[model samples]
Target: MTTIAPSRPLTAAGYPRGFKWGVSTSSYQIEGGHDADGRLPSIWDTRCRMQGKIANGDTGDVACDHYHRYPEDIALMKGLGLDVYRFSVAWPRVLPKGKGRVNQKGLDFYDRLIDGVLEAGIEPWLCLYHWDLPQALDDLGGWPARDSAGWFADYAALCCQRYGDRVKHWATFNEFAVFTLFGYCIDWSAPGITDREAHLKAIHHVNLAHGMGVDVIRDLVPGAVVGAVHNRQVVWPEKDTDADRRAAALLDAHWNKAFPDPQLLGHYPDLIAESIAPYVKAGDMAQICRRTDWFGLNHYGPIFAKDDPNATWGFHWGAAPDDADKSDIGWPIWPAAFRDELIGLTKTYKLPIYVTENGMGGNDKVDDKGEVNDATRIRYLTLYTDAMKEAIAAGADVRGYYVWSLLDNFEWGTGYQNRFGLVHVDYETQKRTAKASYAWYRDYIKAARAAE
Candidate 1:
């Protein structure tokens, strides 16, 4: 039922009954048991080893020590009154070498984490992949290899069979385009390579893997509410010049349409179809297009693209206008874009939508008073949530909202320089202090759920 009038501005956060509120965290970003208990290194671990790839010489080596302190983290989730907790299973942790040798201790760790989340009265949403591919898998050609799809399906089968009884919400992958585009087309992320053909192959292969993973989840896990998470946002031209405009259009295809259009609508985006044609076989779309329960969107803000003849695909990341309000990390803060993306996504994809990740990143530090008062993060959350409520009023099927992170852990590339969590973590002592945004989110959840 409609909770607010369509013509009015969003005043109060009165979402539909049963609206879900939660938080998200990834394995490599937070869980720091790298090399403990038969667990092997992921591509991210290898990336950290390279001399200059990570900032401040920071690594996730002991990040938040969430691997050992998940019980404490689960208490934080309970303290927030979360209805759900979204987390990913590190591939290397489960299959130390990507496949063949199953790590029992690795499996057991997730068992305890899942059980703890359940005991805290929160449902578990387990994402199978969150860009931490096993370094061994990268050695075997990573997502560019067609066989990688089979590897992912086997891994999904392992997870589904083990945890399907308790966990019903399964995401095949989180933000396919981000890792593929950044890793292959740019040197921003791991397994960094810059080749057009490699980028195309990675895109097609990852989409194939997602499709195969979905089928495996359905086959192995009964009552699975399966979906694939895509990082979607508006792509704008960096300048008014024709070159930048063309670059932005091409980037829009790669960033927004490449993954979801094929998986959901059964065809590749026009700009990408011809380039990816050489790799696609007959009926491959049918194989990749599996039935999913929801569209998981991880949106932050609009991206601008500039023409760069020397870059892979001849397009590069640009910046927001100088006057634009930005997060402390320089990410643009435009709630209208978030609102429009939601409304547009509902019309285009026609699936129940869950905002799997949305939050601000800051250079947060605990004050001398032993407290973190991140007032800027509170504003970002307030503006974004109000935009979301506006989207719901405009006929969007948005169901749940989970912030980007639950703790200030290791951010990739930027490393520990960026903090995107509501709860501030003192990386030195492993102390978890709830920030001002944490209290804001907790009360926001309470108020959103209590709305009539």
Candidate 2:
């Protein structure tokens, strides 16, 4: 027993009136009907089929089984009393071969999903792309190809025509940098390539896709609240030296400014501007910089960077100090950095921000009495949310907060070793166990709204 403490009473904490709260989950992470109902292979599916790409040989072949059990999961969301539920639509699901032919079976799955989410009294936030690009599209050059933008736009049009009526909260993509950087440069994620040209091309094309997708959604879906989720984390130097400083600055540009800067501000950062210029044709910036409704920030913690001549882009991921505070998954935990990011993000972007994903991974274990009391996760949420409140008080126009996930599904790269969910999922029996943080968030939302 980790010594369960008494639950605290609700307090307003001065959160603004109608500060929305919810949870976020992606398609491949949870929905594991990999081969069912005309669904085809995504880049992730191809990666999983490759040897030694994912940890522990874990494939999302049966991840949390959300495809089969979403109704039960909707009941879970209803029980939580959320204002909205954020999830991504798998591209390969609706467009089995990327584009051209529509898979009505795949389209019908989301129809039922959106209907169930609405019936549960929770608004559905549909994200168009969460990096599960159709493998057929990858076969045709993936995000590195300029045509990928058009492909994504066609996919967006199909989704808008299908479920745009109920899904008013539309996000074009989720964590653009993560998928592009990891997939093309880092070789840690799907479509694992390490070519510099591929990385830059993927970055530009993905941003172009976002803008095109936004245009399609706005044209098709009336009154659509459109945004794109970007994982914006502060980049820290691995050391205090000039080499480390330069590396951190470049990584910062790629991590923070790559997609959002081009998509929102109309230009690439100076660090990679020249390198990416070859791919930029006339008026491409105008096309990439489409107007969006909100900025979806998916932040976790600060990322460390160091100069690496042998690594991609002349820099590689570095390590935090031995004594630095870390999450269960070894990610550095500095809620103050999170607080500062929120404030800076608000000032820089000047858009209503919604934290689409924020949560910590935990080593959740089912107790002997069939309970998962993940106190560590609860503490992480408290710290982050309190930091967010501080940012809100300091004049950040942050409207909503959605936790990273609803269930502990297949964490990319690390597999299921990292569990970032309010509800714990037992991989063995496919059981969903609400952790202590779930109740905490439920009450937190209640109190924030009650204050109004």
Compute the lDDT of residue 416 as modeled in candidate 1.
90
> Once all C-alphas are superposed, what RMSD does model 2 give against the true structure?
5.0
TM-scores for candidates 1 onward, in order: 0.97, 0.97
Residues 338-448, candidate 2, lDDT per residue (tens digit)? 888888877778788899999998788889888889888888888998898777777777888999889998998889989998898999899999988889888887767
Candidate topping lDDT: 1
CA RMSD for every model?
2.4, 5.0
- What lDDT does each candidate get? 0.91, 0.89
Candidate 2 off by > 4 Å: 1-12
Question: Between which residue pairs do clashes occur in model 1?
Answer: none
